[model samples]
Target: MPTWRPLTPNDITGLMQVANEIHPGLPERPEVFINRIALFPAGCLALEDEDGRLCGYAISHPIRRRCPPALDSVLVEISADADHYYVHDVAILPGLRGRGLAAECVARLLASDAAQGYSVAGLVSVYGTEAFWGRLGFRSVVVDEDLASKLREYGEDAVYLERVLDSQ
Candidate 1:
């Protein structure tokens, strides 16, 4: 059986291992990652196996609007309705891919948000992953020329996507 929990300090090494699997060629310096842990530890979640080995992981946050405009960085521009949660940078282990684990993780995260009274979610697909995200109910948003350049700088082929969560 597998269990999930928030990551802790001792789990940093393991978390970095998992992160590297998803983002190859990323810097491996512990200090750099330590800064990330300090900044958004609550956003990181990990899955453990029966043996207590870290099998998978995911990151989530309640998309804040006080973000600086940066290319490639996620920006959570919520609609005026203000009843949505935007998901970002969701990844599962390669060995664990195609098992619906990503979807399960997303579902659990969204459920938690709904329990907290949120109603929708959104994210930006980096690699023209519209079909994959479409399966999760995220539709692409149209963008103008300047916005398109900014997205290119951020290394994304497309703009944002959003999914409205079902009420429990």
Candidate 2:
């Protein structure tokens, strides 16, 4: 079985390996992970198997609605007035799909201390995963010109999705 644990700087090597294998085209440098962990440690998670090997990772942080960070870019700082919890990224090994790991990750994130101030969660769905996100309570929402432009940075198929938190 795999369990979610706080991601630490020591896990960067394995984290990068998992990221490279899972998101070859949407690569992000280790600095991004380092920055996210430093900014909001509560939102950084690493899934490890019983053997203590990294199998997946999830990164979430409070961000302003209609404005998502660019792919492969580091957020110098979290928003001062961020209104929504953003699921920045979640990647799992192919072997771990269909085990509800993704949903568990998001559920834990939404119930995290870092997510307390947020009323909703947002994400930029890509790689034809709109249906998957839809199943997770996220629905595609049209964005303004500027936001739509940012979504393009992820991919042409990218769609902005949002889910209102149920107040746990």
Candidate 3:
């Protein structure tokens, strides 16, 4: 079975490999992952096997609603008064699919103490994966003109989704 742990800088290369495999034609810079880890280590997680081989990763952090960040860009810091726990990206290795590892990763993330106090979770679904997120309880939301323009940077099919979390 795979184990979950906070992502480390050493895992950047392996994370990039999985990202490339899952996010073709999308821009995902290595520095962005590094910055995310630095900004909120608890929100950046990795899954590895007993042999310590990385198989999956999830990058998330608190952010303002309706203000999804752009793809492949770096942020100096997360918003201090952010209201939503934003899932920036999540990917599992091809060989590890069909085992519910992705759901496990998300569960771990949402349950983390860092995610506490947030009443909502959000993510920008790309690659027609909105159904996957929808199954996870996220519902499609219409974006404003400004946010819609930013979503275009991800791709035409990208859609924003949000889920209201149960009160803690």
Candidate 4:
């Protein structure tokens, strides 16, 4: 059975391995993974096998944006006003997909953020993941020129999606 756990320094390597194996175009460096994990320790979660090998991972950051930030092909930039939790990235090992690991990883991250007092989640979807994010409660938000200009460095193709958490 797969189990979820808070990602630690020890799990960083495994998580990077799985993420790179699943998503080809994403950054797969251990340094980048470590940086994100450090940015949102509580928001990063990992799914591991029975023997403790990582099978999936999710990374999110707390964004203080009131309006959803603009997305333009993965170049997300936050303004001083927007407030929400933004999912940086989520991935599951290709060999271990179809087992709900990706969804579980995301759920775990959201649950952690909620427990930490955050009430919203957001992310930029690309490579045909808009529908997948929609199924997970994310809605499409229009990207404006101001935000688009900031994200122009990442090219002009990434899509933005947001999910508001209910204050239950």
Candidate 5:
């Protein structure tokens, strides 16, 4: 079993390894991960096995509705009045699949955001993984022309999804 904890600067290398394994061809520069942690430490998390080896990571933060930051780009700052808690990225290594670590990490982040009074959660699904996020209660939504154009940077198959969170 693996335990989930807040991500620290020390976990960057392991985080990149998992990111490469799960998100091939996606932009996952170290500075992006570092900045995410700097901006929202609580929303950035790592999963570690009993031996204390990191196997996965999740990065999330508050963002304005219908607006997701561009891939591989760093946010100057997170919006304090943002209406949606956005799941920017989550990845688990191939060997660790089917063990529910992904779900556990996402659940923890969503619950934490809900407790912080965010009524909605959103993610941009790529790599034909919309069904995976759908299983976690997200529903696909048609974005306007402008937002759809922004999502294209993630890849041709990128889909936007959102879910209303139950008040904590």
Candidate 6:
């Protein structure tokens, strides 16, 4: 069975390789991953397959409500006014998609210390993945002008989705 572990700087190379294969059109720089890992290590994770190979990764952090960072952009710092947990990115290798790894990773992330206190978790669902995210409890919300512009950076089909994280 595949499992998720804390991502370290050393995992970036392997993580990027899988990211490229999985998201060729929507590429993010290594610095972005580095920034996220540096900003909130607890929210950074690497997925290791049965043979202990890096197969995927998840990047998340707290952010101001409705202000998901643009794809491939660097953050100077986590928002000081952060009121939400933003699921920045979660990618699984193609072959591993249907095995429930993405859902498992999401559940783990939502329960992490970094995710605590956030009333909701939000993500910019790219690659026509709104339905997939919806199955995980996210629902698309109408955006205003400022946010609508930000979503443009993700691509035409990008949809902003969020799920209430009922406190435990």
Task: Give the number of the best model, judged by lDDT.
Answer: 6
Instruction: Give the Cα-based TM-score of candidate 3 against the true structure.
Output: 0.95
Query: Model 6 segments beyond 4 Å from truth?
Result: none
Write one digit per residue (lDDT tens) for candidate 2, span 1-168: 899999888999989999999888888999999999999899999999989999999998988887888887888899998998999989899999999999999889988888996889999898999999989999999799999888888878999999999874
lDDT of 4 by residue, 125-160 (tens): 766788888988998776777645644533455667
- lDDT tens string, model 3, 1-168? 987788999999999988888888896899999999999999999989889988889999999887867889899788877989999988888788888888888888898898899999999888899988988999998789998998888899989999988785
Model 5, 83-125: lDDT tens digits are 8889998888778888888888888898884337788899999
lDDT of every predicted structure (CA atoms) = 0.60, 0.90, 0.88, 0.67, 0.87, 0.92
Residue 83 displacement (Å), model 3: 0.9
Q: Write the residue-wise lDDT of candidate 6 on 1-168 in tens digits.
A: 889999999999999999899888888999999999998999999999888899999999999989888888899999889999999899999988899999999999998887889999999999989999999999999889989998888789988999999784
Q: Specify the poorest-scoring 10-residue window by lDDT in model 4.
A: 66-75
- Please give the range of 10 consecutive residues that has the lowest summed lDDT in model 6: 64-73
Of models 1 and 2, which has the larger lDDT?
Answer: 2
Q: Which candidate, 3 or 6, would have the higher lDDT against the true structure?
A: 6
Candidate 3, pairs of clashing residues: none
lDDT of 1 at 18: 76
Q: Quick one: RMSD of model 4?
A: 4.2
TM-scores, all candidates, are 0.69, 0.96, 0.95, 0.77, 0.94, 0.96
| C-alpha positional error of residue 165 in candidate 1 after TM-score superposition, expressed in Å | 1.9
Identify the runs in model 1 with alpha carbons over 4 angstroms from their true place.
25-43, 64-84, 113-115, 143-150, 153-158
Q: Backbone clashes in each candidate structure, one number apiece?
A: 5, 0, 0, 7, 0, 0
Better of 2 and 6 by lDDT: 6
Q: Every model's Cα RMSD, please?
A: 4.8, 1.1, 1.1, 4.2, 1.4, 1.0
- Candidate 5 has an lDDT of 0.87
